[model samples]
Target chain A: MLIIHTALHGEARALINHFSLKRQHDMNAFACFRADNIFLIESGIGKTNTASAIGWACGMLNVSSPVMLNIGMAGHTACSIGECYIANRIEDHATQHRYYPPQLVDTPLGSDCLLTLDRPTENYPEKCMVDMEASAFMQAAIRFTTIELCQSIKVISDNTLKPAGRMKDSEVESLLAPHTEAVTGLASDLGQYRAELMDNTGATFSQLTQQWHFTKYQQQQLARLLQRHQALQPDEELIDTIPAWIDSGKAFMRWLDGHLNNLPVRL
Target chain B: MFSTIYVEEAVCDHPRTRKILQHFRGRTVIECRHYGELLNLKAQNFRLQKKQPALILAEKQGKKILPAPAGYHIGARHNYYFSHMLNCIYDCRYCFLQGMYQSACSVLFVNYEDFIHHIRQQALSHHDEAVHFFSGYDGDSLALEPLSLFAETFINDLRNISNIWLELRTKSTQVRSLLALEPWPQCIVAFSFTPEDISKALEHGVPAIQQRLNAIDKLQQRGWPIGLRLDPLIDIEDFEQQYRGLLQQLFSVINIDNIHSISFGAFRMPENFYNRMTGLYPKERLFAFNMERHDGIVSYGESREQDMRNTMREMLLEYVRPSILFPCVA
Candidate 1:
C-alpha cells in the first residue's frame, strides 16, 4: 500500500480527486483517506507531527513494506523558486547525515541532495536546499517499517534564500496540487508494472528449465565443454546433438558439449 | 520442497521465530551450537542447494558493524557496514558465499538488537568520523526484509547515531519499507546494478533493470537520496555502448543534483572462491570469460580490466561530479 503524508489537506484532497481516492475520515489529530489500496494522511506540519502521524497510521495498518511518501513544498537551492526538482538524495543537515530514497525511474531525476533540518536555514547556499521535517518523519516512520517503505517528495516552493514563512499556505498548497496529480499517476503506473513483472518471471523460469535439461552429472560435464569453448550460445543443432556426442564419448565432442553447458545463460 | 529450519539456540524464543519458521513448514529443525560450524562448512554443493536452499535462523553473536574498505566512502569519512543476515535468496553462479559456507541454506540472525548494540558501540568509538556500515554484503538486504524486518530495525538505530552512516546495498526492488519512511541523511539505500543484458543473463531471480530504475525513480520523486553502484562490472561485447547506455538511462531521470554517489568496478573474485564456483557450474559462460589469476585473485586479464575500468570511468566523468564518482579500484 502507498501511504502519502502531506502538511496541506487541500493539496491532498486535490490529489485524491486527481487519483480518484475516496475521502475516508478525519481521525481526530490527523485526517485519514484511502484510494485503490493507497492511503493518505494529512499529518499537518513539522517533522515531529509527521513522524507521530506516520507511526500511528502504521500501528493501525497491517502491510508488508508499506510505502510512506511525504509530499509537500520544499525550497530549492539550485533550481529557481517555481521550478520542480526531484530529490535523489535527502540529507538531514542537523545530523550531518544523508539517505538515498528509492527513486521511481531506471534513471534517477537528478543527482542533487536535499537537506532536512529542524528549521529552515536562512541564506542557504545555492548548493543546499532546506526542508522542515523529512528527517523526523524518516526517523519515526522507519521505526515501524523497513527502508523500502519510507520516502518523502517535496516540490520547490521557494529558493533557499527566500523565507518559507513568506510563502502563504495557500501558495504552497497550489504549488503542490498539480504535482500531486503527476506523482499519483506515476505511482499507479509503477504499481501496474510491478504486477506485470512478477507475472513474467514465471514464464521466464519455465522457459529456462525446458531449454536446458540435463541430469546432475551431465550438467557438470556440459559445464566443462562450455568453459573450454568459451561460448554461451552454441548452434541449436549442435545442442541437440550433445546427447549423441555424450553417448559416443569421443574426446573432442565430449569436451565441446561439456564446455558449452557450463557457460552462463544470457537472457 | 523439504522443510528445513536451522535455528540459533539463543533466539529460539523470539516472537518472530514462530513466524519465520512457519515459512518452512514440515522441515526438520537442526540446532547448531555455533554459527562457525555452519559458516565454515567447505564441501557443500552450491548448485544442488540452489534447487532447494534451506533456512538458517540464529542469533547474531559478535561485532555487527565494521569499517568499510579504505577510500570506499562516497562522501562520508566514517564508513561502517553491518549484516543482520548471511546468504542470499538468488543463486548467482559467481557468489562467494557458496564457497565460504558448508551449506547453501539462507541464514537469518534473529538477534537484531545485538547487532544494534554493537552498532552503537562502533558509532561511539568513531564519534568524530562519518562511519558507514553497509548491509547486503553477506546477503541481499531487502530480499527478505518482509520476513526479517532487518533493514527496518537497523535503519532506525543508525538514524539516531549522528556520526554513523548506513548503506543498504541490494538488487531487490523491495522498497516498501524505504518508501514509507521519511528520507534519512546518514543512510544510503544504494542499488547495485548490472546492465540489463548482464542481469537478465547472469543475475538469476533478481528484479529487472527497469524495475530497479522504477523503484529508484519512485523514491527519488518522494525526496529520497539515491546511489548508483555498477560494481563487479562484467566484460561484454560492445561493452562501451552497454555501460554508456546504462549510465545514460540512469542519469537521465535520476535527480542528478540529489545523487549521493555513483560507483563502478571491474569484476574480481578471490581465487579460491572462483575455483569453487567453477566446480559448481562448469557450464557457466561467466567462468569461460578470459580471466587470469593474479595474486590469489581471479579477474579479467589486466589489459582488459584496465580498458573496461578506464572506459567506464571516462563515461561516468561526463555526468557525475568527481567527488561523487568512487572507482572501486585505484
Candidate 2:
C-alpha cells in the first residue's frame, strides 16, 4: 500500500487523476482520496500539518507493509526548473539534525539533499533543495515504519532564476503530470515486494494459537521455525505433514524438532 | 552497479571521492556530514538493500589499525587487521557480514593514507618481529579492485616497510592489478575455496572455482607467493570424494613450494550473528545444519567438525607440508 502525503491540492490532483482516486468522506479533518491500496492526503503546508496527516492516515488506514511517499515542490539554488529529485538526505535547519531516507530504486529522476526550513526565503546557501514539511514527515513516519519504506520526491519548483512565491498550482500540476505513470509504477513495485516479504511465513501465530496453548517465547520460536520452513520449501503445505488432531502444543513442537532433525543438515 | 551514492561531506572534494563521483556520475549522489548517519541506521533490511546496494564513500576517522582476532593469523606472533572497505560484492549465503552488519551498503573508507600510517607505526613498533598485516577481513580485498585500485596504491605505500607481511584474503578472481605490478616480496594473495558444487550452491555472485584456480596459477607463474584458504568448510553428502578432489585440483594448478600457507576451519559464527543470519536467510542450508551453541557461539557439532577437519587434514597432507598447515580452532 502507498500512502502519499502532499502539501497542496495540485500535488494531489496529478497523482489522483493518474491513479483515478475517489474522494473518501469529506467529513474528515483532512482531505483524503483513495484508489485501491494507494491513498493521498493534503496536509495544509507546514511541518505540524504533515505530522498530523501521517497520524490520521495511520489510524484510519487498513493494510500491510504501507510504503509512504511525500511528493511536492522544493526550492533549489542550482537545479533546473521542473527537475524532479528524490530526497536522500533530509535536514531540519532549526534542529540541525539530519535524517537519511533509504533510496532503494534507480529511477529516471535524480536525487539531492533536502533542507526543511521554518520559513520561506530566497537565500539558498547550500546546494540543496529547501522544503517545509519533509523533515517532520520523516520524523513522524519513522515511528510507524522503517526508513527504507518511506521515500520523498520533490520537483524543483523554484531556483535562483525562479522565486518560489511566483510558483502557481497549475505549474506544479503540469510538472507532476508527466511523471505520474512512472511514480505510481514505482510505488506499486516497492509496495508489492515489501508486502510479500512480510507475508513469507506459512501460518500466522494467531491461527496456530487457536488450536494450541503456547508461551510467548514458544510462539516466537515456533514462528521462526515455520517461517524458515516456508521460505525453504514454499511449495509444501505445513498442514499436510501434521496429524489430524494435535494433542498438545508442546508435543507438536517436539514432533517438529524431531522431523527437522532427520532432514539433511547440509547440501 | 550502484543505484545511489552517499558521500561524506568531509571527503566530498577528496581526490578519491572525486574519482568515484566522476565514474558514478549517473548515480543519485547525496552528501552527509558522516557515513554512519546513512550506513548504520537501524531496521534496514539487508536482504532487500542488497538487491540494489549503494556505494558509500566516507573518510575514516580515529584508529585505522587494530589487532587481529586471536585465532586469525598465519605463523606470525605480531598480527593485525585493517579494513579499507566494509560489506562485500559477493553474497555468499554463509557469510558472516549479513549478520555482523545491519546494512549491506559497501562503505569504502577512502583515507588509505591513515591506514598506511598505522601500518608503518605497527611495523616500526615491532622492528625485530614480522608484523603481519591483514586486509579483506571485513570485505573482499580485490573484488572492487577495478574502481578501488587499493592493492595497487597500498602496495606502493608499503614499499619502504620491509619487516611487515601483508595478506590480501579474498575469494575474487580480480588479480589483474597484482599481475600488472611487481609482486611485493612479503605480500601473499590468499584465495578461499570450497568444492565446486557446494560453492556453486552457496557462494552466489562469486567467480567460478576454476577461474580462481587459474588466477592463482597466473600469479604463481609471475613468481608471486600464493596462499590457499579452505576455511569455513561446509559439510556435504560426498565429503571424502569432494575434499580429495579439491585438494587434487589445487595441487594440479600450482607448485606446492610456491604456496605460502594454508588454513582451514569449520563453519562457525557468533551467537548473535548466527541468529541474525538465520533470520535473514532462514531457508539457507548452511544455517539449517546441525548447529549448537556453546559458550555463546554457534557451530557445527564438535564431532562433526573434528571429523571433517581430520579428513581434510589427511588429504591435505598428501600434497602440502605440515608446517604451512594451520587449522583454525576458532
Candidate 3:
C-alpha cells in the first residue's frame, strides 16, 4: 500500500485525477483520497500537521510493507523552476534532527539535500531544496517502515528566478500535471517491492487454526513455524506439506519440523 | 548484493573507500560523519533490513587487536582476534552476529594498515608466546576478501612475523584470490561446517557443503595446511548418528593426518544475545529449544551437552590424535 502525504490540495490534484481516487469524507482531520491500493492524505501546510496525519493514518492502517512518499513543492536557491528532485537527506531546522531517506527503488529524479523549515524563507539555505513537511513526514513514516521504503520528492515551485508566493493554485496544478506520469511510475516501482515483501510473508495463521483444534500457545508456535519457513523458503507452499488429518497444532509443528528439509531448496 | 552504500565522510577520500564506491557508482551513496550514525541507530529493525541491507564503509579509529575468548583458542599459547569487517555475507541462523548487532548492514573498516600495525605490535610484545591471530570472528575472513583485499595483504605481511600464526576462518568459496598467491605454511585456512541436513536448513546464503569442501581440497592440494572447525554443535534428535555422519564425511575426503587442527563446541550464546536473537526470530526452532543459563551463557542443559560431547570425542578420536582436536569446554 502506498501512503502519500501532500501539503496542498493543488499538489495532490494531479495524482487524485490520475489515480481516479475518491474522497473519503469520514477522514475530516485531513483531506484523504482512496483508490484500490493507493492512499493520498493532504495534511494542511506545516510539519506538525503532516506528522499527525501520518501517525493517524498509520494507526488506522496495519500493513506488512507500506510504502510512504511525501510529495510537495519546494523552493530551491539554484535549481530551475518546475524541476523535480528526490530528497536523499532531510534536516529539521527546528530540532536539528536529521533523517536519511534511502533511494533503493528507481525514479525519474536526481537526489539532493532538503532543509525542512518552520516557515517559508526568502533566502534559501545552503541545501538545494527548502520544504516544510519532509523531515517530519520522514521521521513519522520511518516509525512504520524501514528507511529504504520512504521518500521525499519535491517539485521546484520557487527558485532564485521564480518565487513560490506569486504562484496560484491553478498554476501549481498545471506545474504538477507534467510530472503526474513520473509519480505514477515511481509508485509502480515501489509497488513491486511492496509486493515482494508481502508475497514472502503475510500468511495468516487462522487458516490452520480454524480447522485444527489448538490452544493459544500452539497457535503462536505454529505461526512462527510457518513464518520462518516463509522467510527461509520463499518459493514453496509450506501448507501443502501438512498432513490432512493432523488433529492438533503441536502435532502440526512436529510434522512441520520433520519436513523442514522437504521444502524444495532454492539458492 | 547491497541495495545502497553508506560511507563515512572521514574515509570518503580513502583509496579503499573509493575502490568499493567505484563498483556501486550507480547506487545511492549516503555520507555520514561516523559509521555509528547508520549502524547504531535505534528503532532500526534488523529482520526487515536483512531483506535488502546496505554496506557501510568506515575507518577504525581505536584499538584494532583484541584478545580472543578463553575457550576460543585452537593450539596457540596466546590467541588474539582482529576484525577488518563487522558482518558477513551469509545469513546462517546460528551466527552470533545476528543477535549481537542491531543492524544487518555490513561495516567494512577500510583502514587495513591500522590492523596490521596493531597485530605486529602484539606479536612483537609477546615474542616468546606462540600467538595465533584469528580473522573472521566478527565477519567471514574470505567472504569480503575480494573487496577488502585484507587476506592477501595481511598474509603477505604476516610472512615476516614467524612467532604469530594467522587463522583465516570462513565458510566462503571466494578463495580464488588466495589461490593465486603462494601458500604460507603458518597461515591455516580454517573452514567451518555443520552436518549436511542442519547446514541446508539453517545456513542461508552459504555455498553447499560439497562446494566448500572443494575449496578446501584445492587449497590443501597446493600444500597449504587446512584446519577443520565444527563449532556450536547443534543438538538434535538422533544426535549421535548425525554428528558421526558429519565427521565421517570430513575424514573421507581430506587427509586426516595432514590436517592442522580440529575444533568443536556446543551450541551456546550469551544470555542477552540469546534473548535478542529469539526476539528477531521468534519462530526459529533453534532458539525455541529448552536452554539452560549458567552464569551468563545459555546452552543445552548439562546432561544433554555432555552426551553430545561424549559422542563427538569418541568419533573424532578414530581419525586424528587427541592433541589436534580442540573441544571448547566451558
- Report how far off residue B230 is in candidate 3 (Å): 1.4
**Candidate 3: deviation at residue B116, Å?**
1.9
TM-score of each: 0.56, 0.93, 0.82
CAPRI class assigned to model 3: incorrect
TM-score of structure candidate 3: 0.82
Model 1 lDDT at residue B227:
83
Instruction: Sort every candidate by lDDT, greatest first.
Output: 2, 3, 1
Q: What are the runs in model 1 whose C-alpha is more than 4 Å off?
A: A1-227, A230-267, B1-3, B22-30, B35-39
Best by TM-score: 2
Poorly placed runs, candidate 3 (over 4 Å): A35-38, A60-65, A75-85, A93-96, A106-112, A119-128, A159-165, A174-267, B238-245, B278-298
Candidate 1 clashes: the total is 103
User: What tens digits encode model 3's per-residue C-alpha lDDT throughout B1-330?
Assistant: 887788888999999899988888788787777777667666555666676777889999888989998877888879998998887878889889888887888899999888898999999999767789999999889987777788898988878887879999999988887898899888989999999988987898888888988888888888788888888798877677787898888777788755899888888888988877876776566765556898888988778777777789889998888998888774
Candidate 2 per-residue lDDT, tens place, B1-330, comes to 787788888998899988878878767787778878766777567887888788899998988989988887889999999999989988988899998888889999999988999899989999768999999889999998888889988888896678889999999999999999998879999999998888888898899989999999999999888988998898777877887888888898989989999999888889999999887777666766557899888887788899988988888999988999888886
| Second chain alone, TM-score for each candidate | 0.92, 0.97, 0.97
* Candidate-wise lDDT, in order: 0.68, 0.84, 0.82
DockQ of each: 0.07, 0.47, 0.18
